[model samples]
Target: MDKHLIDDIKHVSLSLFNKNFFGVYHGSISARVSASGFIINSKDTILDEVTEESLVRLDCQKRDYRWSMANADVHIHEHIYET
Candidate 1:
């Protein structure tokens, strides 16, 4: 994972925490790692516990780590990649 993206996730997750948007294990966050790929929170993992290493890498064409993103709003990321 890129340091910048890890930082972004930290900031976004902290912001969500501040807004009471996530509880102990409630929400997930993800970001595009590249034009054809993304790194998303692992399935069932809590937002507060997310770390750079825990973010699973996924390639749209490969679908290798698709299950890792089962808990996230993957369609949004897919749309972003599509556009």
Candidate 2:
């Protein structure tokens, strides 16, 4: 992913957290990276303190569970990407 994009996600996540839009370990953020792939925040990640390491890449075409940091709402993000 591009450094600027990643930074933007982090900034937004932090802003949302700071504004009480998403509490600690509550909400999630995601960005479509390709036609069949995207990056989403990990489960239990504090939105106020999001880091690059807190993001997980997922393949929308396949139902793979190999990622340890994948968020619980990953399916939702995938569905959005599909549309």
Evaluated with lDDT, which candidate comes out highest?
2
lDDT of 2 by residue, 1-83 (tens): 67887899999998888899898888889998888888999896888887888888888777666355688777777789984
Model 1 per-residue lDDT tens digits across residues 19-70: 9997766777777777788777776666766677667777776765465555
Candidate 1 ranges beyond 4 A from true positions: 65-72
> Clashing pairs in model 2?
none
What shift in Å separates residue 76 of candidate 2 from its native position after superposition? 1.4
What TM-score, over all chains together, does every model reach? 0.75, 0.88
